[model samples]
Target: MQNQGLLKELIQSLCCLPGVGPKSAQRMAFHLLQRNRDGGMQLSKMLARAVNEIGHCRECRTLTETELCEVCANPLRDAETLCVVESPADVWVIDQATTFKGKYFVLHGRLSPLDGIGPDQLGFELLEQRMATGQIKELILATNSTVEGQATAHFIGEVAGKFNIRATRIAHGVPMGGELEFIDSGTLAHAFNGRREF
Candidate 1:
């Protein structure tokens, strides 16, 4: 079945969102047109505003409307210990999960040379500059457990070592309450390597 021009355009645009396929986009378009026009309009306006105004924080590289993010602006946060993450979303997760008191540095992406992403693309230069300031005493690498993430963490660790700053990777292992049988080999290995006396 062929949709009218505007409806088709709307569905197509919705499909641009990650994990949204044509059918889901069509359902969303229909839902917006038939049941929730007000909500849809609000979403559209907010999307436009965010797209136009939101930008990376200069210090941490997280999304923000101003030069620095709220975390970077707050004076009470621990400036001597920085948590390095793969993206802004990780920052939010860490904030929600732990009682961590440090500032953050968002890489925005992991190292992927095949896709041409490298230190420059991941904002390593800015990170180095921050390290050179002698304000950060330690770096906590919270990058993902993927190959690229590990490689990125190693690269950052080497860079931190050059500046005489300590760096550590977040522990990867079987999650709390997870059975050993269900855990992957890599995670099990990491768990063994990161093990400490109980």
Candidate 2:
């Protein structure tokens, strides 16, 4: 029975992943043990290696295997402009979608006081130290549109302002090709308010 021994342990272990329930984990365990043992072994090895070796970048706090992330090490990237984001995943998304040549600072999460997450937890001390260096000319707040994200951006903006560095927030709105009729009201309103002269 899956509840009795190693199968139970495997299922419980897989359930640690986001969105993976007992049933889903059980299915995955069964699939791996039955038809894809080699693939499962590969996955296990890779996962272990990634977990053990991957670490936060020294400068930007993004996931990396070295002292600094590729962006931070690259000479071509603009060091004067830095994009601040909520997570390491945000860095990947922004890099692939935009032509921005600026450097990045991964916050890893926004401010959420209720949950006891503060600037210290999100590496704001490091960010402040970077700002104190005066190498950065602009701080781009690319945080999410949520209330917590907005508050986090504002807090960082204030910090940048104290150092005379310009801070700008990323514009939020509807998708590029989305029709107004199908778009959600909140996004539509935000888009209208953010509109500028073409």
Candidate 3:
């Protein structure tokens, strides 16, 4: 309980990650100290390296090591179809589910008013810019069904309307208030297949 200086800083920094509470962070810190010193050091090094190397894809706003992510750079992927998601993690979940030939646009966050997150913060402006190119034929709204996620999807629908692009929201299958990241690949694939128009 009396952790100070470097140990306290490490625990506090670990708590910054989502779902990592003080207790969990403390456990993680101690785990690193006691058992996984080398792994912990590598993790720290990777985190620092990624912080320097990975950045948002200029086109879709997903995290990338370069100007564009793999999906954007892939010649085989359909550039005209765009899947919009709340974060880079959602993009990965969907990708793992298989055969989404279209590219993706990652919002990096959702519209949570309680936390003061809004459309601007979710990068709707960048999406509008992408749509303005007129090459995108469809925009898939894969945001979750939580209040904030739904709000974000609706906002995207409005933006899509201005560009005359077809907008669809991935169906609710996992559960109400559930997140895409936690859903199994099978369920996620079904949701993607069963998507409906906004």
The clash count of every prediction, one per candidate, is 0, 0, 0
Model 2 scores a C-alpha lDDT of 0.95
Q: How would you encode candidate 3's per-residue C-alpha lDDT over 98-180 as one tens digit per residue?
A: 67899999888898888888778878788888899999999999988777788889988988998999999876667778898
Q: Is candidate 2 or candidate 3 better by TM-score?
A: 2
Instruction: Summarize candidate 1's per-residue lDDT along 65-180 as a digit string, tens digits.
Output: 99999999999999999999999999999999999999999998999999999899999889999999999999999999899999999999999999999999888778999999
Q: Give TM per candidate.
A: 0.95, 0.94, 0.75
In what order do the candidates fall by lDDT, top score first?
2, 1, 3
Q: Which ten residues in a row have the lowest lDDT in candidate 1?
A: 1-10
Question: In order, what lDDT does every prediction score?
Answer: 0.95, 0.95, 0.89
What TM-score does prediction 1 earn?
0.95
Order the numbered candidates by TM-score, best leading: 1, 2, 3
Candidate 2 lDDT over 20-138, as tens digits, reads 99989989999999999999999999999999999999999999999989999999999999999999999999999999999999999999999999999999999999999999999
